[model samples]
Target: MNDKLRSKIIIIALAPIIFILNIITKSYPEFIEKYYSTGLDRPIRQGLSIITGVFPFSAAEFLIITLVIILVISFIVLFIKIVKGGFIKQLINILAFASSLYIIFMIFWGFNYNRISFDKIANLKIEKSSKEDLYKLCESLIARANTLRSKVYENPKGVMTIQGGYKDVFKREASGYEAASKIYPELGGKYGPPKRILLSEKMSYTGITGIYMPYTGEPNVNINVTDYMLPATAAHEMAHQRGFAREDEANYIAYVTCSMHPDNDFQYSGVMLAVIYSMNALADNDMESYKHLAKTYSEGVRRDLVYDSEYWQKYKGKTEKITNQVNNTYLKSNGQKDGVQSYGRMVDLLLAEYKKK
Candidate 1:
């Protein structure tokens, strides 16, 4: 009944209120589509991105680092408090913090989860694509990738390399989004350009190429990956920054934006990303055909894939598995029923678009 205890109870009460409102929003995707997605979220997302875009470094990354330090300090403090048998106050503080985060997330970007999917916005008719369709898509993408590999610069080892460093790549990436906005105007605005992660090597170990921080509306890219992957990864995160929440749709948008880009490097990167997804689906369907088509990759493309594979191979361990599980759970909690498998849905979008072409 003391002031502190009453405050804790009120904070805990807000959690169920937030949960019920979330359920109401989820039940009416149409309302969210018309009001939140097309109306409120767009302006909110744009305003945050524009404000944060002016900075050279990522505010989100800085916040993350600070949060980590705070967490570490909190654990140390909490341990000492428990040793002193002051557990009640510590528990209340932790609960209050957790509830506050849930509410803040709801206000900032979590409600966007209840909005109509990018599938509806893009009018994509996703279904179980036939094996033949997937195979053809892979073959076509491989050919396109091969053509693009020839135009780009290569390292001494014959692997494709970006002509300029990641800083230049970040500058050029906005052009793709500009082109994409023409096709789907929602993705077209002046958002914050992608920020390179200083801890990109650590990020790569978790299998994350890029991430969109909704808190700051910034797209943070993992530049440690190969040049061919960088452009698409940046574009993909930019897609999320623009309010395309679905992973597959973001990937498709990245492909569209990068392919529409005039630069051959961007074009190749877009095609290469799509090809990888398409080939992956084919591998699951028919390993023999997948191997046969994979064998058709040009020497340059082969070397590039191998290098990319080997780079990731070194990081395949407990941390990567744990991260994957966390990501899977996160996706599921956000209404992605397929969880981590939702990523494979990008292949469906790819097939739908390719069939149209």
Candidate 2:
């Protein structure tokens, strides 16, 4: 075949291959869940972590290095091309290359969607458990937390010291992405650690939502007008630090751990939040109660939630819309039916697990 015809054929073939992969991924959700939840993903991440630990460059430093190398190489190539051909030819070539890169990026993003469906989680249904039973489970979790807290106070001075609290614990937990990448090299991507933890910020499409950068270890927990939600977000990030990649598992851990905490604020926030899910599971129509409880939050928390909603609304551009669509598609391909909303499905899992115990 001619080169043009060959290229067309290759592009045509790509779609079917991606489709097949998506089907396979969706077909075996359990397998993928097991692989991630078990320690299977750890070895690759751990090995890469050792190398990065030794090198020790911050995220910004690494970005600077990458940009410098790309610019230097691009300048050298352009200079050579200009000398050999002409300025017009080099400019045309650069534009063509840039266009091609954009196309490739879009195509790869589409494929990535096929590989990681979110809808499966959204579609999952759990057997309904009584509120009393769930509350009992919560009490058990609280007891467990008390036990853990006792352990923490065993070295109370050491655990609560400024060095340990702000420096060590925070630093270690924040290094979640680095640690995950070290253990699972395949999961490593261009973004390393996230640059910032944007709190109470609005997201683009959802108007109000939380986002965690699983690849970068950045936690942007955008909650709607609720100080009670902050501790859960913190606990969610802590779950990521402990290597729980699935959103639902992290949510479950966050709810349980925070509820168990000694601080009243944290416990109140955790229990109240869990009640939202418990109601969802049990009540036929509880949106009224949900709204009432949500309104009970302090004005400060409500302000944060509103600011967060507005923030995302302001940034809801074409880029974000495209990103959401692609992400939703990807989640569906991976076994999640409701796309990103599947993250909230953890409520069912948490209820089930609590009942089992």
Candidate 3:
């Protein structure tokens, strides 16, 4: 009966309205592509990105930390109230807040899941490749990675290191998008630089290298990831900013942008991304061929890969398994039917582009 209760009911009511709109968007991809993705969403994304970009730290990261703390405090208070026999009121307050997040997510980023796919936007045909095709793709990536490895700076341990550390990496990553956007204008807009997470080391345990915060239009990267993979990972998150919502498509864009980059470090990281994917696909089909081609890796490239393996090995366990399960469900609900496996679909994009060249 109070104004607060009435407002919560009104906000919760919008959930169904938004759900209907979500269905409409999903049903009409062309409509969302024309009206939302390339139209209204551009300014929204760019504006939020510009505002957030001014800050040196990750606004989204800090916001998440704050929210988690608040949530814990809320549950504690709710429990104490329940012990005193107050429950329904607290429950309604939580539900109302949840409904608001759902609304915001749909307005800012959820509709993007319905936009025209990157393959169509880029005019590339994705087809299943033969084993030989996979083998050829892996071979080309390995060769490129080897050549670029010699060009980048490496630590005394022989592992790759960014020329200017993370600051330089963040400063320079946009250049890759600038170069690639010329060829594929769909990913053309400039937004904020990627923000390095203060909790990056902790995030590594969940196996997430980079993540895009759609609400703020910010690309967040885990600096704890190996340097050999960092630039490409940054580009991957940026692709989400350009409206490539699918993991596979974002990955393909990362490769395109990285290859177009002038710096050898960016190009090398990009090639390594492709190499790992193509080689994994090849191994899945023909382990003998994968083993044979991997032997051709340069000593520097091999050392970097080994370090990358070791860096991630320590993070594999129950935490990663649970995280992967949750991510799989999230991706599936958002139209990635293959779930986490959709990431490997980037190989199809690579093979398609390879055929064109």
- RMSD per model, one decimal: 2.4, 10.0, 1.9
For each candidate in the order shown, give its overall lDDT on alpha carbons: 0.83, 0.45, 0.86
Q: What is the TM-score of each candidate against the true structure?
A: 0.92, 0.45, 0.95
Give the true-structure RMSD of model 2. 10.0
List where candidate 1 sits over 4 angstroms from the true fold.
Answer: 1-9, 83-86, 339-343
On residues 1-357, what C-alpha lDDT tens digit does candidate 3 reach at each position?
Answer: 999999999999999899888877788989999899888888888888999999999999988888788778778878988888778888778779879888987777778989987778878777766888888888888989999999999999999998678888899999998887787877888688899999999999999888888778899999998888889999999998877788888888898899999999999999998998889888888999989998999999999999998878999889889999999898888887532232266888888788878
Estimate the lDDT of model 3: 0.86
* Candidate whose lDDT is highest: 3
Question: How do the residues 96-172 of candidate 1 rate in per-residue lDDT, one tens digit apiece?
Answer: 87787787667667777787766667776666667888888899999999998899999898988987879889989
lDDT per residue for candidate 2 within 1-357, as digits (tens), equals 677545555555555564576466555546544554234433433433333334333332344356568667766778887778776545544444444443443232222322222223323335655546554544454344333333322123222112232223223333333334453433233322212223334342443344443322334344333233555665565554334545555566566555555555455445545654554443433445445445444443344345445544665677677777786775554454421222145655665556554
Candidate 3: worst-modelled 10 consecutive residues by lDDT: 336-345
Model 2 spans with C-alpha error above 4 angstroms: 1-22, 25-40, 47-125, 129-195, 198-228, 237-246, 260-269, 276-284, 287-327, 338-344, 353-357
